[model samples]
Target chain A: MIEEFFLRALIAGVGVAAVAGPLGCFVVWRRMAYFGATLAHGALLGIALGLLIDVDPVFGIAASSVLIALIVTGLQRQGAIGGDTLLGILAHAGLALGLVALAFMSVRIDLMAYLFGDVLAVTWSDILWIYLGGTAVLATLALIWNTLLAITLNEELARAEGIDTARIQLVFMLILAVVIAIAMKIVGVLLIVSLLIIPAAAARPFARTPEQMAALAAAAGALSAAAGLFASLQWDTPAGPSIVAAATAIFALSFTFSGTLGKRAA
Target chain B: MALDKRSAGTGLLVEAKGLTVRFGASSALDGVDLTVSSGEIVSLIGPNGAGKTTLVRAVAGLVEASAGTLWRQPDLRIGYVPQRLSIDRVMPLTVRRLLSLAGRSSGAEIVSALAEVDAAALLKHAIHDLSGGEFQRVMLARALLRKPHLLLLDEPLQGVDLGGQLALYDLIGRLRRRHAMGVLLVSHDLHIVMAATDRVVCLNHHVCCSGAPESVRHHPEYTALFGAEAARRLAVYTHAHDHAHDLAGNPVAAADTNHADNEPEHLS
Candidate 1:
């Protein structure tokens, strides 16, 4: 039973790493850390909608995250308010609304399972969705990788070269929504932001290029996921938090090592 | 891939029609009309708040023009090197990698672009380790690597040393002659503007003057836009000899002030 649990977690962890690698690179590159959180929080609303409508929660999550992404993009373009202020309002509102909606559900649901993922409870079907969603996200990201990196480096420069930033941004956000929705199962909504950030941040100091950054981040994410799963198994801790904790540990170690290297070079 | 369409037979790489830009209440650029013909290098100059950057950003489409349109030749590819190239140092990147990030380019192309700005040797160096001049050259190399039909540069000489500035100027000269690419440069270097640019556009929230650099200097509108004192200061900033110490015998505290003093005012 323990071996089976470990194997299941490993499959799910790979799915998360595959999506997080490239998406996380963008998160760090575009300085979209808060934006990543916004999308993650918005996933809760997706969950609530899914449960309320008797549909798959992942579908609901993708839809809700996409909607939130669109809202943020629209407000930013329209200059309704500054991005951070608007994000602050939306982030909390989404969380509050999700909680409120969850409370109104007629049947009691294990809300903690969604917030802090129960990786062990992931069925074979859930594993299929994870792989399918993760593959689609990675393929799409690879196709537009150069263009996306160019835009992230400098928006106007990209535009001048006939790279449609608006179109590219829409595609990027859509992919991010899908990734967030699917990965929410492995890491949970609350901690999904960590998977997107910590691995990427950890890989940043060592990367020579954007490609290297994404590759290293993916490796770091997968390693952390494995390490976290083993630690959680030994200690009987919750899966999602344990994964994030392990990722944080990796980040701490990388930060210290990279810092020392930087000082030595200086 | 659709060809970039521009106005027919204009020979101008970029044309701005009644371009106006505002930041809140005050107009940063007002009714500015300018043109940069193929192979022509146009330099924009003005006082501190004279809307030099505003005009350039408007042209680059970095900032939307409150009113007016900017058109470029259908095939014109613009490369914009912004004034502030400094990002968070924690952001790890290398010069060669940054250039390739623009688009896929051959190693030879990358080498040539770097060679143009004399940054070829530092290709593998991390961005954080690069000097101000070297950093700017990397940006230039990135821009050139794209083989743009038009290059829009904002304060390219801002942090560069005299040698770097001259080297970049030479590269710009080569680009203009070899590729017939139009160059739109915004600089406070008044001395080089007259010599470097085929055309000079004097701007102070409007088209103060636009013509040959020497001719623009003689225009009363140009003098009136800056007034006598400011015009003199701009003249001083432009001239190499005028970089002498200020009233207190200290070097003029300007963006171009070199690192010889090793002051804490590291521009980055």
Candidate 2:
């Protein structure tokens, strides 16, 4: 017999995985893994803000991640500093600020739970947020899939084709913020990007088409979540890192299996 | 196929007057006046860092004109082939998928556009596997798929071999005659320009000289700006090149008929 809490954790993790899979494909394609990490790191400040205001950390995370993403977008026009430098500054600064703010709070905060996810402790309400938020993300992703892919191929080309590339990129970043907001409970702050890029990357060699890659990536993510959950149950490991480990293992397997495919993703 | 856009009076596709673009304190382009009319072929040539590309980008609305006014036909459809399109090696894409980057294109349209560029067979091939010349042809097909009113080619002949360059230039002339498309081409190489090109605008931060291809090459400013060797390379290589060719880049037909009629009178 399955425990209700484990069932809930399984459902929530799987929901987040399904959504992150296709989105991760874009993350990998645009080589925005650092950007993904930067946003996830910013989610901690959001959790602290949520605690300060007596609001749900999920909503706080959504607000902070979106704010950080927009700020980065706007400041990218400032020329001198490279994008990675900007992202690194924002990422570490946000994480440290969250830690400092959390330290000042009166309520007993389980730092471990927020830093690395306490997936085994997931509640039914968290599952609700996961599915509902994941649905919206998947729908929005489908609508902008082609346009996003075009811009990812070449921003200048897409702009010349009359696409408002900046607007599309902004929209994409917002979508990513929502993903971070909902997936935070599943994989915590630091491992969110691991859940994103690894599964998508693992699915790369096997896919002949982009749509195929997205579907395969989603499949890979779901299995990693399930397998990771099982391993956590068996070994009493932390659920967030276990999920990421499972994802990495799958990537290793894919790399080994696809070695004969001749072409490798750079 | 020049389906009478000129008669419909699309007139000027782009008109830029005294355009200036600056990056930080340095200027990329300065005081450049240029225009492209419907059914016109204009070539932009200059030395490296001459802002040839900046002018093209400004006209294409890719860059903001910092100090001057630029005008374009309302709702202008532009087919732009950038100088370099380095496909990300990780992205999974095929030639057939490339043509629809602007928007959705039907299979027939895709096939036809690829055929026009002599790259129809590359439809199923992964873009990562393509050679440089093959990639250029596919990019051209992608540009054509837009059925643009104004076409922008930034150094389109860079990777093509000499024989293929002659053939591709021939194809560009045919496109102008058939579609009446306005072409704004940027060329770094002085090796060749299309026989049908109406204007050659020489640039070195400013409009050094501008006129018909023949007169521009002979202008005193043109000679002074570009020394003897540069001007000598600007000499037009006019030859009949309409014959069909196999994939090996060899002419399949020896029939050279009236294709030469399109060249300047001095060339014949």
Q: What lDDT tens digits, residue by residue, belong to model 1 across residues A58-151?
A: 7887788788887987889899699999888888888889989999999998888778888878778888888888888899998888898778
- Per residue, candidate 2 scores C-alpha lDDT tens digits across B148-236 of 88889999888777656656776777776667789999865542455567887866667655666553354455457645444443444
> How would you class the docking of model 2?
medium
Q: Give me the overall lDDT of model 1.
A: 0.76
- Candidate 2 chain A has its poorest 10 consecutive residues by lDDT at A257-266
- Measured with C-alpha atoms, the lDDT of residue A95 in candidate 2 is 97
Q: What lDDT score is found at residue B37 in candidate 1?
A: 84
**DockQ comparisons of all candidates to the true complex:** 0.43, 0.50
Q: On residues B15-59, what C-alpha lDDT tens digit does candidate 1 reach at each position? A: 889988888887887778998887788888755677888777777
Best by TM-score: 2
What is candidate 1's CA lDDT for residue A206? 84
* Displacement of the residue B199 alpha carbon in candidate 1, Å: 2.8
After superposing candidate 1, which stretches have Cα over 4 Å from the reference?
A: A78-80, A260-266, B1-10, B21-26, B61-71, B189-194, B210-268
lDDT of 1 at A4: 77
lDDT of 2 by residue, A1-266 (tens): 88888998899888899899999999999999999999899889989999999998878887888888878878988767899999999999999999999999999989988888888888888888788888998998999988999899888888877888878888888889988888888888989999899999999888767888899999999999999999999999888899999999999999888893555533
